[model samples]
Target: MGARELTIVLLSAPTDCVDDDRTEQSLGLAYIASTLQAHGYSVEVIELTGLRSSELATALHRIPAVDVYGLTCYSTNYHSVRQIVTHLRSHHPGAYLCLGGPHPTALPTATLEDLQIDSVVVGDGELAFLSIVDALKRGRRILGAVGAIAPNDLDDLPFPNRHLVDQKTFTRTLNHCRTLSLISSRGCRHRCLHCNSVVMGGARKRVKFRSTGNIISEIRELKKMGYGALRFSDDNFADNPDLANLLSAIAKEDILYRVFSRLEQLEPATVQRLADSGCKLISVGLESLNPKNLRFLGKAGMLHCLKNLEHTERHGITVRASFMVGLPYDTDASIQHFFEKASRLPFTEYAIYALLPYPGTPLWENPERYGYEIVDADFTHYVQMGVGRQTAFVLKHTDPETGFTFHPADVLRWHCLAHDLFSSKRHMSNSQVG
Candidate 1:
C-alpha cells in the first residue's frame, strides 16, 4: 500500500453552553488544516462549541480513524481539553496528539508535563504544525517541542480554508446577515497587562500586515462565499499606510462590517475614511478610566480616548466602548468616575468585563507586584463568566480593605452597576430612535 493515507483531526473546544449551537469555524485550526491539506494530509474539523459533556466523549470516538489529533484551546477550556485529550490518549494510544493556541503557547513546558498532550505548538501553528507533521510522518521523535511565530512574510500563508467547515450551518450571524471572520493582520505588541498576545505573537511589539491585495482578495472571496459582512478578529487594527489603500478598495465592495482598533490610531482623517468605507461600528477598548491603569495598559489618557469616541460618533459610526475592571489600585472612586463618564458618553453600546490574568500575561506571572495574591493556580478558573466548570473563578484578592474589604467581588459588583446604568441608557436611546 503506497504511502499510508495520513489522517488528522482538528478540534476546537465548544464555546457555547448548549449543544447544536453553531459558529464560524475556528480560524486558527482551519488555517493549520489548510496547510496540512496542501501537504497531502486528510483533515476534518470538530468544533466542540455546543456539545454536552456526556455526549462529547462518545461523539469524538465515533469519528473516522485518526493517526493524529490536534486541539486548539484557550484558558477557559483548559479542563475540557484535558478531558478530551485524556480520552484520546487512553483510547487511541498509538495516535499522536498535539495542543496549540494561547494557553499551550504561553506554557509549553507545563503543557507537555501534563502528560495528556504529546506535543505543544507554542506560537503561530502554520509552520510549526507543518514541521511537527513532517517529523511524525517520518517516524521521528519530536515530543516536547515548542512552536514559534511564523517568519515575517505573512503574505506567504494561505488564506484560511473556509470550506473545511459548513458555512451555512456554522457561521456568524448579525441581524440576519451572514458574516465571516477575517484577520488582515496579526501580532499587536501593545503592553496591555491582561493581554496574552506576547506569547501568541512575540515580544518585539511589532506588527505585520497582510498585503493590501491579499486582504481585498480574501474580502472578495468572502463575498463570493455569500458573506454579507466581515468581522475582523485582530486584537486592535492600528492605522498604517496600507490601511487607507485597503479601505479605499473596500469602498467599492458590497459589504458592511466592524473592527476593533486603538484610539490613538483613529485620527480625524482615518475616522472619516472608515465611515465612508461602510464601517458600521468601531470598538474602542477603554480598558480603564483610571489614569494609572490607562498608563499601565500603555493606553493614552482617558481624554484622548473620549475625544476619539466623540469623533467616531460624530462621523456616524457606532462606538462600542468596552471597559474592564479588577485592576491594581482600583478604587470605588475610580469605578464611579468610570460609570459617570460611560453613562454620559454618546456611544451606541457599552460592555463591562473583569480582568482574568491569562497564562502568559505579566499580571498572571507577577500578581504580587500588583498587590493581589493569586489564590488558585488552576488554569480552568481563568474563565470570565458563568458558574460552570468551564467558567473561571476569581482566585485573586486584595488585602483586607479599610471599609468595603475590596476584592474581585466588588469589582464584579461595580461592573454590574455600570452595566445596568448603560443598558438603561441604551434602552432609552433605542426608544427614542423608535
Candidate 2:
C-alpha cells in the first residue's frame, strides 16, 4: 500500500487532573499528527483524558483499526500507556506501536521492554516521528528506539492540528473567556533540581523561541477561530529575549492571555507592558519564602516574588502564586512563618504542592547531594498536589544542618493548612472587593 493509504493514529494517554473536566487535547501529539499529514500521509490524532483503565479498552474499540499507533507517555500516565499497548498488541498484532514523551525519554529501553512495543522516540518527536513513518513506508522494521533531534528552527514546524479535537469545547478559562493553550518556545534557562524540563529539552540549557512574526500569525489564526484567550505553555514565557517585541505584537492583535513566569523577569516596566498587552494573569512559582529553601531548589529568593506581586498589582494583572510545601529544612515552625509572610502578599490565587524528585531530574539522580533521601520511587505518586492520593512520594532529610524534614503525614497536613489559609484569604478579599 502507498504511504497515504496506511492509517496512522497518534494516541495521547489520559492526563492527570483533580477532576474529570479536561477538554483540551495534547498539543505535542497534535504536532506529530500535523507533521505526518503535512507529508501527505494519513494521520488521526486521538486524545484520551480522565478515563479509567477499565474504560480504556472500550474507548480503543471505538477507534477504527489503524496501521500505526504512536502513544504519548508521561510518568503519571505510564501504567495507563502500558495497559493501552497491551490491549493494542492483543487486538492488532501487526500494527506498529511506538511510545514517546518525558517518561519514555528518561528510560527508553525499559519502556520498550515494559510495554513490549516496536520502538520508542526520545526527546523532540516531530522530525524523528516523521522519519519513522518514512522508514516504515520503505518497508524497514525498527527494533529498539531512536534519539530525536531537536529542531533548530521551531518556526519551520506546522502549528498543532487543533482541528483533531474540539477547540471550542475547551473548558480552560481566564476572565470568564474560554482559553486555549499555545507554545512559543521550548527549553528553559533555569536548572531547578525538581524539574525535568532540561532532561526533555535535551542537553541544551538555553531557551529557543519562535519568531515574533510566527507567533503572532498563530495568534491571529486562533483569534479568527473565535478564541478570545490563550495560555502560553512555555516554561517561562517572559524568558524570551524578544518579549518586548512579542508583547507589542500581541497587543496589536487585541487578544487576552495568561503566562507562567519565574517572577524574576517581571520588572515594573515588563509587568506594565504585559498588562498593556491584555495579559490578565501571571502564574509565578514562589516555591518558598526562606532563602535557604530557595537556594536548595535553585529558585529566586522571596524578594522576586514580592516584587512580582507588587508590579502585577500596580498594573492591574492578577498573580497566581504557587508554593512548595515539603522542601529540605522545612519544619512546622518555618512553614508557619512562610504562611504568615505569604498571607500578606497580594497574589490573587494560591496553590501549594509537595516536592517530587521526578526520574531523570537532578534531585532524583542524586538525592544525597541535595540533602534529601527518596523514600518512595513509585512513578504513580510523582504528582504535584500534596493534599491528595496523587501527592508526591515522601522525601527525607539527609543533612544534619537541615534540622527538619516532612514526614508523609506532615506533607498532607501542610498542604491542607496552606489551602485553608489561602482559601479564606481569597474569600475575604472577594468580599471586600464586592
Candidate 3:
C-alpha cells in the first residue's frame, strides 16, 4: 500500500491537576479534524483530557507515523503542551507542529519561538488549518502564522467529525457521554472588561451563525447513534437570530440539552419555549450580585438574572450558574455579598473562580488600572486550577490603598463556604424544598 498522509491533532491540557480525568470533550478538535478529513487528509485526534502525565509521551509515540501534529490548548495547559511538542519533534523530526486556540491565537509569535513549534493559527482554525496543510505539502518555506477570518456563513463549513471522539474519555452530564457539542455562532456582542473574545477577534464580533437546517441534520445523526443530548457551546447562544426556528426543530426531536445563555435575554415566552423543548439545564454567568460590579462586567443590572432565575425555576428548568471571586470591582464586602446573595438565588448548581488575567483581556493588559497588582506574573498559573498541581500558585492581590492582600487560598475558602451553604442539596441529596 502507498504511504498515507496522516495528521495527528489534540484538544488537551496538562493531566497533572486533580479532576482532570473528568474534563469535558474538545469540540474544537472535532471541527478541525472534520475539515482536514473533508480535504482528504487522514486525521487522528489524540485527546489528553483524562490521561496521566506519563501517558502523554507514550501516546504520541504510539500513533502511526504522521506528517504533522496539531494541538489546541488554554494558556495554563501550554506548559504541558511544550513538553508533548518536544516529544513529538524528537520522535518525528520532520513532522510540522502547530498550535492554536485561545493561548496560541493571542500569543502566536511567542508560542512559536519558545518551543519546537513550526507555526500557530491565530483565529478560527478550520480553513487556516487546511491552508497550513496545503502549504506544508507543497513544501513551501513559511513564516510564523496565518491570521484569522471569521467564517460568515457557518452552514457552508462541514459538520465537526465526532468519530474522533469514538471513545469516551471526557466528562458527562445527566448520564450522557460527550453528546455532540454544537457551536451555533462565533464572537460575542458584549465587551466585558475581563472577556477575551474581543481580543481573539475584533470588537465588531462579526456574529455569524449556522442555519437551523444544518444544526437539525447533525442532531438527527446524533440521535440515531444513541446520543440523547447536545451541548450548545456558543459564546452567546441567545443572540443567534435563528434561535426560535432552531428550538422548534430540536423540539421535533426528543433531544434534551443545555447551553450558556444571557439570563437577561429570557422573557416569559422564550423560557416557556425552552422548557417545552426538553431543556435540562442553563449555565449562566452570574458574575456578581452588586449592581456596580454587574455593570462593570457589561451587564445592565442584577434584576434581570434574578427575575429570569425565578422564571426558569417555575418552569422546572435547573439552573447552574458561576461567579467570579476576585474581580477588581470586588471589595471584601462585595465578595461576601456575592456568596451570601448567591445562596438565595434560584440555581441549585454553582461554580466559583478567582479572576484570571489571561493574555488578551483588558485586565491582563492593564492590571493596575483595574486595581489589581498581579503578584504572580507567570502564565502557567492561569488555569481555573493552578500549575504543577491544583492550587499550587496563590495569586496575590492588593487593595493598593488599604494594604489589604487577597490570597489564592481565600478563593478556595469562599468556594467551600458557598458549597457548605448549599450543603442541604449538594451534600445531602435533599431535593425537597422546605
Candidate 4:
C-alpha cells in the first residue's frame, strides 16, 4: 500500500453536568497520533464540543473522506461514543471506526459487538493503532478482538503531542504555571474493586516507569516552557521505592510537584523527603474508616494509611484527603464515625464521593452482593449523579454469615451540607471569640 492520507478526527465525549466549554483531549490519543504521524499517516485531532450530533455528521460529510475515524471514550462518555458511532455508521458507512481508552479496554467485547464500532484497541494503543492503520491502508480486515495489546512501556511511547490540543482549553482548566499533568508511569499494582484501572489494565498488572533521566528531561523541558507546578497522574505514585529516588532527583533539580499516594506506603522519612523535594500537596485515598468495609473494597491497610494523612500534614505538605461515604458495611453510626474521624484530621481540602460501581469493576459484577441496584447503565449517569442501593444497608442472602449496609449518596449529601453549616458556625464562633 502506498503512503495513505488518513483524516483521523479525535473527539472527547462530554461529561454529565460539565458543559462542552473545554473538551479535555486525552493524552493517550496524542501519543497515538504522534506515533501514527511518525509512520507517515495524516492525522488531525478536533475537540467535538461545539458540534451537535447532526452538526458533527454535517461536518464529517463536508470533510474529504477519511480512511479511519478514531474516537476516545472514558467511563463518563460511553453513551456519547455509542451515539457518535451510530451516527457515523449511518452517515459515513465507508469510514472505519475505532475506539480506545478505559471504556473500550474494559468492555472490548461489547464495543466490538456494537454494530457501529469496527475495532477496539485494548491497551497501550500506540503500536496497536499504527498496526490497524497499516492494515487498513493495505485493505486488510480489522477485527475487534484484542490485538497487539502490550504493557505500558513509557520509553517506547513518544512524548505526548501537546501541540494537538488547543492551548486556550488547557490554560483555562489547568494553572500551567503552577500545574502540569505528568504521567511518570502507567498501570496500578493495587486492585481496588471499584476502580476502572483494574478492569482496563487486567489482573496481572503490567507497570512501566519512565527512566529517571527521561523524566528529568521532560521536567527540564516543561520548566524551560515555564510550567511551575507538576501533577503526577500515576494511580499509585509512591508504591515503588524508586519513587523516592525520583523525588530526590527532582529536588536536585529544584522542581516542585504534587502527587497521589496510598496512605499505607507513606513513612515519616519519606514524607520528609517529599516535603524537602518541594512537594506541595499529597492526595490520599482515605476511602473509609471501617476495617471490614476497607477489606471488602480490597484496601490492604486501613488504619495505618488513614494515620499517614496526619504525618503528611505535619510535614508542611497540604493533604487533600478523599473519602467515600457509602459502602456495604456502612450504617448511620458508621457514617457518623467517618465524619467524626474526618473532622479530626488536618486535611487542607476534602473531597467526598458516593461509591460509583462502574461496569467491569468487581462491585458491578455482583451488584446484589454489594447491595447496589443498577440504577442506570447510561455512562453519563456513571459519573456521580445516579443513586444505587447502599451496600451497607442490605444483607446478602448467600453470605448470611456476614452482611453490611450503607446509603452512600444520602450520607455524602449530608456531609456536604454539614460542612457548609459547620464552616458558617465556625466563622460565627471565631467572630464571637474576637
Q: Which candidate gets the maximum TM-score versus the true structure?
A: 2
Tens digits of per-residue lDDT for model 1, 1-434 = 12577678999875344223355778999899888887888799877766666777777677555888899978767777888887888888888889998888888888889856778988789888888888777776478866565757777888888887777767465434777888977788576777887767745466777888888888898888888677788877645448888888888886787788888888888889888887776777877777777776667455564677777889887777777777665677777787777678777766566777788888788877766666667766565544321223364555444433456567767767666667645531222111
Model 4 gets an lDDT of 0.66
- Candidate 4 lDDT by residue in tens digits, 149-201: 56355676667666776645552222234355677877788888888877656
Per-prediction tally of clashes: 6, 0, 0, 8
Off by over 4 Å in 3: 1-14, 21-24, 175-178, 199-204, 329-332, 385-405, 424-434
Give a tens-digit lDDT track for model 2, residues 62-87.
Answer: 76678889998888778778878888
Local distance difference test values of all predictions, in order: 0.73, 0.79, 0.70, 0.66
Alpha-carbon shift of residue 94 in model 4 (angstroms): 1.1
- How would you encode candidate 3's per-residue C-alpha lDDT over 1-434 as one tens digit per residue? 12445555554555565454444567778888888888888787767666667777666666555777788877777767887788878877887788888888877777878887778888788888888887776766355877765566788788888776654655555434345577777788778777878665534446777888998888887777777777788876777787788888889998788877888767677888888887877778877777766776677555555788888878987777766666545555655666676778778766555667778788777777756667677776665543322333335667667777767677666555655565443321222210
Ten residues in sequence with the least summed lDDT for candidate 4:
425-434
Q: Among all windows of ten consecutive residues in candidate 2, which has the lowest summed lDDT? A: 425-434
Q: Candidate 3 local accuracy as lDDT? A: 0.70
Tell me the TM-score of each prediction against the true structure.
0.91, 0.93, 0.89, 0.84
Clashing pairs for model 3 are none
Better of 1 and 2 by lDDT: 2
Candidate 2 global lDDT? 0.79
- Could you tell which candidate, 3 or 4, scores higher by TM-score? 3
lDDT value, residue 318 of candidate 4: 73
